[model samples]
Target: MDLDLKGSKVAVTGGSRGIGKSIATLFAAEGCDVSICARGPETIEKTRAEIESHGVKSFGTALQGRDGEAVRTWTRDTCDAFGGLDVLVCSLSAGGGTNDERYWYRSFEIDLMSATRAVEEAYPHLKSSENAAILVVSSMAAAETFVSPMAYNSMKAALITWSKQLAEQFAPKGIRVNCLEPGPTMFPGSNWEMIKVARSRTYSGVLRQQPTRRMAEAEEIARSAVFLCSPAARWVTGATLRVDGGYTKGVQF
Candidate 1:
């Protein structure tokens, strides 16, 4: 599958590591120029180099996902740098926390607002592209009861609704919008990796729920994400694709 993504300009938030990094890397592998943003300067530079190593242009910025202005700036800068934008993948997240009102604000800013802000900023550029798409990286936790009540799950659920509505609104403009729900993906420095060590029982419980008895890898989720945003999936929009490796129990239909 060529993906027909050569020369496409793509942007991904939180792309320095974990699933975001994988998504950017895969896009670069498919010959798309990629721009990424993350809070850590070193990680951002490193990931940029890795993406560029695949022979496509790579741009990166060091900034917090919750910073709306910074996100919009990155979106504009990416379009300027690459001439235009073809795909936007909102992959930044604040992770999970419970009981604290501050956690709610943090998750809202990082997870939900980041996607909304990026899409708002990227909309004009996306509308100019021949094939434009947006992929919001959510979690299976959004659709299923995976853990205790927390802001992360709720905010992700909000994204699913937003993605659907955006899909409908942008359809006439030729821009597709979709969401992806990944479950218990494990990678170096990922929250799941820490939970596996510090909260072994909780990690074990999640793994046991998967029929595969193992968590998904960041690349596994990235592959599905790239396909959704590619020309190959031009007809896929307003759809929430769950790439959870059977960790989610509810029937999607």
Candidate 2:
């Protein structure tokens, strides 16, 4: 089916690697002009090249997600460069850490504020689009208790709430908002990869709970995201999807 995504403009925070990169690339493959913002220029440029390989225009910006001004600036630049914005994916995250006080601040800034800032900056641009959609990348950890209590888990849960509220507020303007809660995903250079090597017990504990006895790949999560963010899923706003390969046990009504 045609996603009706050709020629659309998309911006993805943290699109240099992992799920964000997969989402951006998939959008490009569907013929969307993609813009990515991440922390490292080297990775951003390389990923930008990969996105352009799909035969769509790609832009890259290097900046820390915690910097609200930088995030807003990137949003504006992306809209300006692409002529307008139709899709925005907030997929950057400050990974989970011990319940240190500082981790709270870090998660609050990068995990939560980054999405808020980008949405605020992109609101008008999205309002002007015929097919505007936003996907907030939370975690399955937010829907169910998976690890020790940490700021990452709570902050992600907050995103689910915020996305739902935004969906209600933005629907009248033709802007779609939805949240995706990905389960423990593994990929090259992922935090889970590092945890697998350094924290085997915790990693094993998580795998034991996954029905498939394996983690979901980033692209697998991105597939759902791309569909939800595309015009194909025009009526799918205000929904929170837990694409975890059944890792999360809680039933959603």
Candidate 3:
């Protein structure tokens, strides 16, 4: 089924690796002009090349996710490169550490505020598109924690709330805003060693909780994302689409 996304211009944050890279590649494959940003210049260029190889116009920049100035500059550069923008996929994330203060601040800036800046920057361009969509990539940890740091859960929760508000605010402009919440997904950048440690000594068993009994693939989440950004989901706004493998089945209490 055609998602009616050809010729659309898309901007993705954290698009240098992992889920972000997967989203960028998929968008390019769908015939959309794609632009992405990350901190590492080499990795950003590599992802840009990969997307361009799909025969769509692509650009990338080295910009720190936690920096507002960087976000503004990158957004400007990408929009100029693509000529226009239709979809904004905010997949920002950050590392969590054992140190309480460092963990809290980093999580707040990267996971939550970075997305805020991206959306704010892309609002003007998205408003000009016929089928504008904003997809904020969150995590299942927002609803229920697993092995993620406390900051991770908190920041994701903030994203859900922010998406809802933006959806309402943008409804008049015909822009649909939604969140994609994924559970345990097998992405390259994920710290598998940390997951292993959690599984061996955590409060909840990750594998056994999910009905699928297996981790999800990055493509699975990307498929949902593409659909959400497509014309098919024109009416889907202020919603959270859980791509988890039936991990949350009713109340456990």
| Inter-residue clash pairs, candidate 1 | none
Better of 2 and 3 by TM-score: 2
Question: TM-score for model 3?
Answer: 0.93
Q: Residue 176's C-alpha lDDT in candidate 2?
A: 99
lDDT (10s digit) by residue, model 1, range 1-253: 8799999999999999999999999999999999999999999999999999999999999998888999989988988999989999999999988848999999999999988999998999999999999999999999977679899899999999999999999999999999999988889999988888989999998878889998889999999999999999999999999998887778866
For candidate 3, write residues 117-166 as lDDT tens digits.
Answer: 88888888888889999999998878875564578778888899999999
Off by over 4 Å in 2: none
The candidate scoring highest on lDDT is 2
Q: For residues 149-168, what per-residue lDDT tens digits would candidate 2 score against the true structure?
A: 99999999999999999999
Q: Tell me how far the alpha carbon of residue 109 in candidate 1 is from the true structure, in angstroms, after superposition.
A: 0.4
User: Candidate 2: lDDT of 64?
Assistant: 94
Supply the TM-score for candidate 2.
0.99
Please give each candidate's TM-score: 0.98, 0.99, 0.93
Clash number for candidate 1: 0
